[model samples]
Each structure stands twice: as C-alpha cells, then as structure tokens.
Target: MSLLVAWQLKDRRVLIVGGGEIASQRMDSILVTDASIAVIAPEHRLNSRARQLIACHHARITHHDRLFLGPSELHNIDMVLTALDDPERSREIVLMCRDARIPVNAADIPDLCDFYFGAQIRDGPLQIMISTNGNGPRLASRIKERLQRALSGGEGEAITKVGRLRTLLKQKAPGIGGDQGRRRMKWMTRLCNEWELEDFAQLDNAMMKSLLEDGWEKDRIPSLQDVGGTCSTRRYHQNFHSTIPLAVGFFVGVFTTALITFFRHRK
Candidate 1:
C-alpha cells in the first residue's frame, strides 16, 4: 500500500510540465500553498485556463513560454508534475525526475508516478485525503463529494478557531518537550475531547481566553449550558455529554500526576 503523507510545501520549488486543463488543475491545488511554481509549455499551446492561472499568480508562478528543454530544468526543484499530452515526453520528464531524486506525479502514467494527488477535501487548515492507490480515481471523487455533503461548514471553522487557541497556548506553555509542554498537551487534548464540534465552533475570543484561564487557574472547563453559544443538535449533544465524565477523569488524572511530580521535585 501507499504511505500517505501530508507534505509541507511552503516556500518549496515545484516544476509543472504541461499547460493543459489537467495541468492547470494540478496548478490550482498548489496555488493554495506557498510553493514557487514553474510551468513549462509553449505559450501558444497553453489553454485559456492555464493562461489565466499564470496571469493571476504571476508573482508565485514562473511561466516558461517553451517546452521542457532538458535535465537542466530540474535544478533546485523539490517536486515535479508531468501532465503532457505527449506520452514520450511525459515519460522522459518522469525518468529525469527519478534520476534527480525528486518525487514526481505523472498523469495517466501510474507506474511512473512517485505520488498521486488522490481525492482531497479542504476545510481551511484541516485536510482529508482519500486515495485508491491508482485503482479508481472516479470512485475516490464520488466518496469525497459524499463526505463534503455530510460535513457542516462548522467543522472547518472549529479547526480554524482551535488553531488560534493553540497559538495562544504556546505562549503560556513555551517549549514543546518539557513538563510545561506535557501539561499543555494534556489540557488541549482534554478540551478537544470534552467539547463537541458544535461547542468548538461557537468559541469566541472571550470564550477561548476563559478556557485557557480555567485550565491554568481553576482546572475546570465549563459545560456548554453555562457558556451558551452552541449545542444545536440535541441527540449528538446528549451523546457528547455522556462522554464528558470519562474525559474529565482523564484530565483529573493528568492534574494529579503533575501535582505529584511537583511535590516530589520539591522534596
């Protein structure tokens, strides 16, 4: 099976060989990241959409108004995508990338591909990817559509808001490999489990600050009834409340451990 990974593409250099609709679609996906893109294909061969992508993202994208010349083009490139109509040329680029030790995605050429784009769902910073391992892309697309339909937009919003909370938590806890970090992780994990998706979605700046405050001083995060922002689905909300006792027990265990460590160190 394929080992799926979420690659960090920020400020990385990526080379795209071809300027067709398919190539442009691949380009669109990366445009969401901070990658420096290089598009290689004759200016005359570029489709309208491809041309538009270059025009809009000229600062981020470098368009070469000519076809892939040789191996020299692969220099300093971290990744490559070949979506060429010319099978021979696509194969050539794939082989070249392989020689240069760069991961490559070869459209319609599964055997040559080091990676597959798969079917992807994006909810701000949260991403869910479904891959059939080059078996059925059409099936993957259908699955993605179904999943997207099931998600409330709140799923994305909650993640975005929680991410901001994490940033604030870093200031209180500091380095990620010490006692303070351990406490921070346990506290964050407790919040994520005890709070429902709806609960997280409703968090305002004041509520988040209150959460951090409670964790630090009071050692208690309040119930949704006390906070009054969400719990829109009664059935799911009830289910979540049922699990809170167990979650709280876990947090309490963590707190007890921290206290024991502190007293032991002091003695």
Candidate 2:
C-alpha cells in the first residue's frame, strides 16, 4: 500500500512541463498552496485559461515559453508535473526528475507518476483527500462529491470554531509537554468528540471565548444527549466493543502471571 502524507509546499518551487488543459488543472491545484510555480512550454501553445492564471500570479509564477531542456533545469526544484501530450517527452522529464531526486506526477500516465493528485474536499482548516491507489480517479471523484454534500451544512463554521478553540487553548495552556500538555490534549479531544456542527453553529465568538476563559464549565458545555442520541457516543462504543477480545487477552495474561507468582511464594 502507498503511504499517504501531506507535503508542505509553502515557498517551495514546482515545475510544470506542459501548457494544455491537463497542465492548467494541475497548475490550479498547486496554486492553492504557497509554492513558486514555473511553466515551461511554448508561449503560443498555452490555453487562454492557463495564460490568464499565469498572468494573475505573475509575481509568484515564471513562464519560460519554451520546451524543457535537460536535467540542468531540474536543479533546486522540489517537485515536477509533466502534462505533456507527447509520451516520449513526458518520459524524458520523469527520468530527469528521478535523477534529481525530485517527486513527479506525470498526468494521465500512472506508471510514470510518483504521486497522484486525488480529489479533495476543503473547508476552512478541514480537508479530506480521496484516492483509489491510482486505479480509479472517477470513482474517487464520485466519493468526494458525496463527502462534500454530507459535510456541507455548517461544518465550515464548526471547523473555524474548533480552530479558534485550539488556538485559545495553546495560548492559555502554553507548553505541550508533561502534565499540562496531556491535560490540554485530553480536554481538546473530549470537546471535539462531543461537539457537533449544530452546536457550534449556534454559538457566537464571544460565548466561545467565554467558555475557553472559564475552563469549559459543565453548565456552559452543550450536551449531545439532550438533543437526542449522539452518533459520537455510538461510534466510541463501537470502537470500545471491537477491542474487547484484546482487552480480555491482556487481563488473562496478567492473572496467569499473578497465579504463578503466588504458587512460587507458597513453595
């Protein structure tokens, strides 16, 4: 299985080796991050949208209006994306990237890709990425659509509130080691588990700030039980039950050890 991770691309340099629709789409995706982008393709070959995007980010993006040279151009680049129509040119770029130790995503050719750009659902600090191990992009897109719909109602606001709460806790709690850090982590995790989008949607910034300042009093915190059965509680219980066999085995091992110790003392 391929290990998935989120790469930090802020202020990093990325190279795009095509200027067509696929290249434009890839450019759009990378633009969301604070990466310096360079597009190397013939000036007249780029689509209008691609041209516009490049012009819009002229300060951060540099357009080379020519075909890619040898591996010399790969120096100092963190990643490369080749959306070239020519399979031979794409392969050449991939080989050069591999030699330079740079990760690459060659559009439409899974075998040449070091990574796949999966469909993503982003909502104000909350992001969910869906991938199908390079087997089904369309299926991933469909799943992303369903997830987007399910997460649409007031979730953005909820995530914003949670983010604010976390910042407040960090400022108040300060260090994240030893007893203080563990306490803070426990408090935050419990709050996240119990709270839902509906609960945060009704809360104003002032109230939330007050809750933070007051150390999350029992009366101040909203109870999921009052609003009917909580899905979070059900999920927690389900997880607990699933681990019962392991828990039983652990207890049995401890009991057997204690019994052997008692018999040795008697002898």
Candidate 3:
C-alpha cells in the first residue's frame, strides 16, 4: 500500500501515550503542526526544553503517572501515539486504539501504526519527508540526514512569485481556462526558470505579460503544436529562492544605487 501523506495539521488533537524519551522526541515533531496535544504519561521524564514548551503552550497533558494499559486510557482521543518501549504493551495499545477507531503509532512498530512518522527535515517553508516503508528506521534516518545536507537551503519565494503572477493572469483574463490554464502554467514555468538567469528586478513585467498572453493564445485549445511545446518545456523551475534575502538585497541595492547615480549625473 502507498503511504498516506498529510502536510497540514493545525489545531488537530494529538495524544502521546508515554512519558519517556521516545515520547519526548515525537513531541518535537508533532509540535510543529501547532496541533492541540494531550499527553498521557504516568511519570514523564521530560527534559528542560520539552517541559518549557509543554508548559508554555498550556497543552492538556494529563498525567496518569502510571502504566497506560487500561481501556480507559484510549478514551476521547483523536490520534494516539504509543511510545512505550515494550513490544507487547505497544501492541496492546495499538489494538486498543484500533478498536476505538483511533489512529495510533506504536514506537518502532510501523506495521501496527495506523500512521507512521517519517524522518523529516524542515527548512523555513520547505519540508522534506523521508520514510523506509517500515523496514529500517536507521536507514530512513541516514537518508534524512543526507537529504538535510543536500536540501538545507532555498525555498518557495520564487514559487510564491509565480503564484502572484498566476493571480494577476486570472484578474486580467477572467475566462482563462483549458488552453488558457495550460498556457499560463507554461509561461509561469518558463518565467520561473528564466528568473534564475537574471535578477528578479531585471524580469520585465511587461515582457512577462506579453509572453503569458502569447502562450495563452496558442494553448487556448490543445493543438498538436501545444504538445510539442509542452514536451520541450519539461524543465521545472529550479530552486531559485535558495538565497532569498541575498536576492532581495541585491535588487534593493541595485535600485538605490541606480537612483542615486541618476540624480547625481542629472545634477
């Protein structure tokens, strides 16, 4: 079965049914979702930082301060995360959660888990998730580290710029559909690629508008010509926003320098 992927988890209820180090580690990942957390640990060995976050967020961490093997432990929870180190206990908890129609993830037991936590790398708005289909956690972690080093930089600012351009297109041409959508995507794809070749400030808005109009005209309906163009335009936009602040600063500095130089020469 293909693994299910969920990227957004704001304000969702998440329950961690352990109070030890493993549970603590899982909390670090779950907290990023900004979800409501209700931790049920008998005696939590939370470190300073984890405790600080738990206290600060005012998370509903109900402490049983004992073993959580009872059926009552699974009551009224949306998603359950069982981090108990014992295999049998973890399996039991998973079964209990399953009976209650609740999603559960037993520590180191991906087969039992309704949802498995992938090794994750977060860089600003960009998140890379790596999983090993429940075979090897260590392998997954190693791969995650490699991906972390590889994709440690760049983000979606360029993508966001393309989004803004598409919005502009929709505003200008209300009836942009079928060929229009294809054409808009094509122009966006090309512009985003070209954005890498020069400064964003050098990207003439008039030229972009002209190109977008032209592409839309051609692809207004899927013709044989459209297929060939789309085939040749297989290149997706590169990670152009790898140095966002640098790009922004460069543009800003160039503008200020030009303005000053123009006024001085005019004088």
Candidate 4:
C-alpha cells in the first residue's frame, strides 16, 4: 500500500497549527518548496526550533502570536498540519479543515490525518520517503538511514545533469509526447546505463550540449572519451562480483564460530 505521493506545493498555502518540534520538522520540509506558510499557535508555546525559524525566515513565513481562531484562519489555505499537544484542539482544527475541503495531517493522530509525514532523504533532484502507513515510524527512520548509506553522493548532481540533458533534447528535437518522447526516453535510458555516475556528476554545460549535438542528433554515438565519460559500468560490475567470495567466507566463519560456542556451552 504505497499511497504516498509528491504533492506539488509550489506557491500553495500550507497552514501549520502548532509550534513544537513535530510542527517545526514539517515546516522545515515546506521551506524547501515554494509554499506560502502560516503557523498558528501562542508565542510562548513555541519551541526553540520554531522560534529559530521565525527569526531566520521572517520574511517568508508568518507566525500568528495567538491560538487558532477556527475555520476563518484557514481561509484560502490549501493544506493544514496540526501538531498540538492538545489532541482535542488539534482534532477540532482537523474537523474545520475537512469542512473547508482542505487536506490536513494531524501529528501522531493517524485516524484524523489525511496524510502522514514519513521519514525522508532529500538530495537536489532525488527524494526518498519511507512510510509504514501509520505504523512503525521508527522502522521507517532506520530504513531511511540504510538507504542513505547505500546511495553514492554523486546521485544528486547526476540527476540534475540528466534534467539538463532532457531540457536540451526538448530544444533540439522538440515535440509533445509521441515518437519524439519515445526516442528521448530511449536515448536517456542508454545514457543512464552506459554512463557512470561520475560522468553525469561532472557533466559540464558545453560537454552536455556537444554530446547531444554530435552523438544523438548525428545518429552516431561517439566514443566515451569524446564527451568525457568512461565505460566504468562494466568495471563496477566486476568489482561487485569479486566481493562475493569474501562475503561467503565471512558468513561461513561466523556460522562455524556460533556452532562451536553452542556445543562448548552444552558440554
């Protein structure tokens, strides 16, 4: 049940109805987007992080110095998030949002929320969110940590470079979905497979345009060096395969040690 989606919040208004750590975290996420944010809570209730946001992003965010005033406060609000310690008050705000047809998420109150903010890993053009569908948020966080370790840091820049290449394709071979789209997809896939992560990470503007002009448009894919890329994919595959023997040996040693220790204890 992967129901999570990347909502387009650019220029949309998001209302947060608390001033605690949970609310601060959700507001941190919104700050990355072009969303207009307004937080409602008494000034004294604000945590240190919440106060820091107020001090830093003063121009970008508006924080009301009082408690939520009901649906009137939610006027023109596209989304609502409530992280109040008082569940009753939070629930009341949720009800108001529902009445006004606004999407809402109530922190730690699964049944009242229209959405949940899952553990997330964010890079330039890459965002990975792990959710347990209102169950096991700790596990979701552990999974996010594991994924962060698995990915190479070059990915963010690589994805950004790929986007630049896509933009160039649209300019050189412009068309709105059809054969042109399919052709673009095929070429993009080819590059993703053949080019190493470092190649994309280091793809300069001049090299990017030249690659498209000489390689794709010319109907002749040139040598890797011509556009400053290496065929390191095969080398990486070889390196991965070479580690299998060492992994097997390490696991076998662990199993044998466990068995010997168990038998000694039995004796």
Candidate 5:
C-alpha cells in the first residue's frame, strides 16, 4: 500500500476511448459524476436506453467513425476511461494519459488502470463503497445487491441522520474520545434504533435540535425497552384480528371437508 491514490474529476473533462458496449457501461458511471464527457469511437453500437442517455444527457460523446487516436483528441481532457476491445489500443491510451499525468481507468485490465470503479451506493450525503480489490466483480456485485436491499431508499436517510448526529456530537462534546466517545456514540445509535426513524420522518426539527444539544447526557437518552415493548404490543394487537380470521377460515374449510367425507361414507 505504498500508494494512496485519489482522483478528482468533479466538474472536469472526461474522455472515453471506445464506443462499444463496454465503453457504454463506463459512460454510465461517469455520467453520475457530472463530468463533461466525450467518447471517441470509430463505430456506434448501443442499446436504446444507452442511446437515450447519451443523447438527452450532457454527455458530449462524438463518434470518430475512424480508427485512429490522433494527438488532437486529448485536448482539455482531465481523465480518460479506455474500454476498447483491443488491448493494444487501451495500452496506448494508458501510456498517453500517464505521460500527460491524467488519471486513467482501463476496464478489465488492472495493470493498465489508475483507478478501479467499485460498487457504490449513494444515500443523499451518505456513501457506501464496496470494492473487490480487482479480484472478483461477481462477489462485489452480490454484496452490492445485499447492500441495496438493506440500505437503499429510507436506509440512506437513516444513515444521513446518524452522520449528522455524529457530527453534532463531535462538535458539542469536544475532547471526548476512547470510552467516553464510544459510549456517547453507542447511546445515540441505540436511540436511533429504538426510535425506528425509518417509520418516523416527521420528527420535528426542535426535537432533533434538542437531541443534538443534549445527546451526550445519559439522563437525556430515551427508554429503549419501553419503546420496543410498545412497538411489540401494537404489532401483536394489529395482527391478532387478522390471525383469528385466517384461523377460523382454515378450520371451517377442514370441518366442511370432514362433513362431506362422513356423509359420503354414510350414503
């Protein structure tokens, strides 16, 4: 780990050196970055959705329709993503980017890449990064799917709340670290869990403000046991009627079958 690699393409120019399906996939990732993109390819082959994206979005991709990597093509490019089917062309693009000190991502070729795109889940200001370390993309994708199931939609909002609370704690409880900091964070996290804020988005700003102001004090912490007990009681009561109706229906069906069988035997 001698290298601590980081690249900033925010609001910068992104050049892609291919136009096939592989290049189209890379285009999707770069689009999210809001980077000004230009794709240079000799031909065009894309799905309907992909074609729509390139056409409607700010992606400034222009197909070369010619097999050549001219020096003029590198004009004002900050980053390059090479996804050409030909390894030799990809290698050449990497070399050009290296000489120019521009960041390059070569798909399916770790040796030629400056950065590897990982499975990323963005929840507002919260980001969960999952990387396979260039070993197994299938495993990375599997983990990403699980994370999506667990943390997408409302999950992101919950995490954002946690982050805001942590920031507030750090600012409010200065110099508190080790056991004290851990205890404070643990308690705040537990409060979130107990509240199940996923279902309670209407928590007033005043209450959130108060929580941030007084979250460090143990006395201010809400009773988790009482909250959980109430939730459980409510669930049981709500489902009790539904359960009874289903049970009665099942028994009636069984009894009717039994009666039919007995009458058939008598006859």
Candidate 6:
C-alpha cells in the first residue's frame, strides 16, 4: 500500500526537467507551495504558459533554459519532476534521482515515479489529497470534485473557529492541570463534536467573551457517561478469552517437562 503524506515544500529546492504543457501543469501545482523551483529545458521547447509562470515567479524560480545534463544537477535538490517527452531521457533522469537519494515523479510513467501528484482540495488550513495509487488520475480528479462540493459550506471556517476556541480555552481555563486537564480536554472534544461552525460563527465578540468567562460549568459540560466506551473495553475481553487457553497449555507443558526432568535427575 502506498502511504499518503503531505510534504512541507516551503523554500525547498525542486527541479523540473521539461518545459512543455505537462511540465507547466506540474509547475502550476508546485508554485503554490512557494518552493524554489528551477526548470531545466530548452527555451524553444517551453510552452507559453510555462514561460509566463516562470517569469511571474522569477524571484523564486531559476530557469536553466537547457536540457538537464547530469546527476550533478540533482545535487542539493529536495525533489525532482521529469516531464520530458523522450522516454529514454526521462528514464535516465529518474535513475539519476534514485542515485542521488532524491524523490522524483516521472510524468506519464508510473513505474519510474517515486510519487504521484494527486488531486487536492484546499480550504484555508484544511487540505485533502486523493490518489488512486497511480492507477487512475482521472478517477482521483472526479473524487476531488465531489469532495470539493461536499466541503463547499463553512467547514474550513468551522475548523478555524475550533482552533481559536482551543487556544482561548488553554489560556483562560483554570484547573487545566493533572486530572482536571484530561477533563478539560474531554469537555473540549465533546464541544467540538456537538458544536458546528454556524453555532459560534454567528456569535458576536461580546457573546464569545461571555461564553469563555462562564468556563466549564456542570450544566454546560458534557457528562463522562455520554462518551462512547473505548475500543480496548470492547476488544480486550474477546482477545484474552481466545488466547488464555493456548497460554495456559504452553505454561503447563513447560512445567510438566521441568518437573519430569527434576524427577529423572533425582533417580
């Protein structure tokens, strides 16, 4: 299974080994991350959009205006993307990236890719990335569209509000240490589960201040009984019953052998 993860690419060095439309698509995606991007392709081969993007981000991007030469070019690069039309050159670039211990994505060649640029949906601090394990990018894009619509409401703003509330709770709430800390955390979690973005988003600053001032009152706080039982409680007994017989038999056999050996030695 391919492990999905989000990379922090801010100010990191990324090298792209093509300048056509495919390369431009990759460039557009990478540009948003504010990475130090360099495009290595002949100036004549570059598409108009690619050139424009490079020019716009000239401060952060370095256009080589020529084909990638050797593995030496891969030095100090955190990630590499090869969108070259020539399969042989693209394979060579992938090999060089492997040798340099750098992660690379070879465009249109799933076998050579160390990573795939999956379809993503961004909502303020929230980001969702979807991948089909390189089997189908089109399907991933379709799913992304569905998710985009699903999250079109105030989901992002709700997360931001929860974050702000959490910060306020940490600063203002007294008895937030020891057992009280866990109680506060459980109360906050319950609040998050019960409250929606609209619940707090419509409130004025004065109302918010008033709510915080009230703190964790017995009436306002969710009861511990309301929380669902833990997985351990549900599964532990089942596992213990299944394994105890085997465990007991193994221990009995060992003890029997030991006792027999001791009797034999005495004889």
Tell me the tens digit of each residue's lDDT in model 6 across 88-149.
99999999889999999999888998888888887766778998886788999999888876
Residue 95's lDDT within candidate 5 is 86
Q: List the residue pairs that clash in candidate 6.
A: none
Relative to the true structure, candidate 2 has a C-alpha RMSD (angstroms) of 13.5
lDDT of 5 by residue, 52-98 (tens): 65678743555455554555677798988887678888888788888
Deviation in Å, model 1, residue 55 alpha carbon: 0.9
Q: RMSD for each model, in Å, please?
A: 15.3, 13.5, 12.6, 6.6, 6.8, 15.9
- Global lDDT of each model? 0.85, 0.80, 0.64, 0.85, 0.68, 0.77
Ranked candidates, highest TM-score first:
4, 1, 2, 6, 3, 5
TM-score against native, each model: 0.84, 0.77, 0.60, 0.84, 0.59, 0.69
lDDT tens string, model 3, 133-178?
Answer: 7777799899987876644244444344455557777876666568
lDDT of candidate 3 vs native?
0.64
Better of 4 and 6 by TM-score: 4
Per-residue alpha-carbon lDDT of candidate 4 for residues 84-158, written as tens digits (9 for 90 to 100): 999999889989988999999998888898877888888898888899876788999998889987776777888
Q: How far is candidate 3 from the true structure (C-alpha RMSD, Å)?
A: 12.6
Worst 10 residues of 1 by lDDT: 226-235
Query: Relative to the unseen true structure, what is the Cα RMSD of model 1?
Result: 15.3
Off by over 4 Å in 4: 230-267
Per-residue lDDT of model 1, residues 1-267, tens digit only: 999998889879999999998899989988988799999989988899999999999999999998899999999999999988888988989889989999999898888899888889988877899988767889999999999877766787889888888888898668967887888788778778887775677778887777777655466667655555655553474567669998999999999999999999999
How many residue pairs clash in model 5?
Answer: 0
Which wins on lDDT, candidate 1 or candidate 5? Answer: 1
Instruction: Report lDDT (Cα) of residue 251, candidate 3.
Output: 99
